[model samples]
Target: MDGRLIYLMGPSGSGKDSLIQAAREPLQALGCEVVRRVITRSAESVGEDAEGVSPAEFELRREEGGFSLSWRANGLAYGIPVEIDQWLRKGRHVLVNGSRGHLPVALERYPELVPVLLTVKDEVLRERLLRRGRESPEEIEARIRRNGLFVGDGSIGDRLIHRLDNSDDLAVTVNNLLSLLKLSVKPDQI
Candidate 1:
């Protein structure tokens, strides 16, 4: 059987990175491979375990068809290497940190993918974004507003979109994700 793709997406401060980090070992135990993205940013940047490349290099790779999925978001370019297709064909479940804006294209390519949306309460999101110190208060407010708009607008589509709340403990979110994965993917393999 072919493996399923777990496309995880969320607002900026929704703890997607943290959840992925925490769930790595458990997911591996269940034969799942969490993909590392290729991003147009410095490796020194404090974020997910993505491969940082220059804009020129990123464009070169994209043009060469090195990526199975790619998109630009938050002024940065992100790519999922084409190797994920091989992994899926080999029956290894794969998880990717995906973009909500790019979900339509992703679904078009992999219609059986499990789309997960990580969410946080407004106050919690504000506090988390403030702690990151990457954005001004005004910018944070705008992001929060945008997040609210997206969630309320039904732009992500309600079909098969599993929502996970990351307002409290990280463990809870990780557990929730694992449970969802177990159910969404092949339970016999797990």
Candidate 2:
């Protein structure tokens, strides 16, 4: 059996983090590993910021063969650890928070990769962004502008891909994803 790789990519305020957090436990209970990604930015307030490492450190790690896949997005670097390969080797699917730009490369090399594009109404996204209070209104606007980028827009990666909506309750969004991915779920009954 071939394993699968699930990627959740979206706009900044589309609730990707919230959806990931809500689904983490239930997904794990189903014998799945939601692969945590490493980033080059300070974790600060993004609850699931993974772990932070400097760009230099990330480069060194990359040279040492520490990452299965690493790429930059919005001026920040992110990577999936090589250990995840072990899970895939055994036909165990792994879910990850990933850059949408990686979709094309992933599709080419790892046929198992499944990209899940997330979207929300702009107003809803703006409200969530404001509530987070992590960015100034200007920054929020910039992010939203950046978020809508896609294939025809000369964006970094292919925009034609599987997608999921996150406009409903956070938990519902997660379950909807699980359903779409055909991933197993443990009975937390959420």
Candidate 3:
């Protein structure tokens, strides 16, 4: 069975992490795996299961071909370990939290990529970002502005882009994702 690669992309504070966390166990039961990433930021700074490395080290690994896919965003570098290829070869349906800017390169690298764009309303986004308390108000505003570019541009045309609105109940969003992945979960199960 050839595997499918689900590439997840969303603006800051769009609840991508929350949806992934909630869907992981049920996805696993359906023989799907959510891949972790390697980042140049400190593990303490990000709330994800990421392998942290220095900028120099990240460059070294990138040069050594240790990553199947890599890109820099918002002053930080991210890499998907090459082990994911092995998993795909084994017919494992793999999902990855990825950057929107890197989707073109990833699609070129993995022809089977299925891109999903998780979106939230402007008010909801502003509220969520403020609640995060990770970035300065200025930074949050910048992020909100950046998000406009992705959402406004109709550039994702003709590609298999799955868009989900996460402004309301999280369970509804998760259910939509499960349905998109063809994995069904009972209401009480998730």
User: What's model 3's overall lDDT?
Assistant: 0.84
Best by TM-score: 1
Residue 73 lDDT, candidate 2, scale 0-100: 78
Candidate 2: where is the Cα deviation over 4 Å? 150-160, 183-190
Top candidate, metric lDDT: 1
> CA RMSD for every model?
1.6, 4.5, 4.0
The candidate with the higher TM-score, 1 or 2, is 1
For each candidate, what is the lDDT?
Answer: 0.90, 0.75, 0.84
Task: Please report, as a residue range, the 10-residue window in candidate 3 with the lowest summed lDDT.
Answer: 181-190
Write the number of the candidate with greater TM-score, choosing between 1 and 3: 1
Model 2 poorest 10 in a row by lDDT: 181-190
* lDDT tens digits by residue: candidate 2, 80-144: 89988888777677888887767777677676566778888777888989998988999999877
Q: Candidate 2 has what TM-score?
A: 0.84
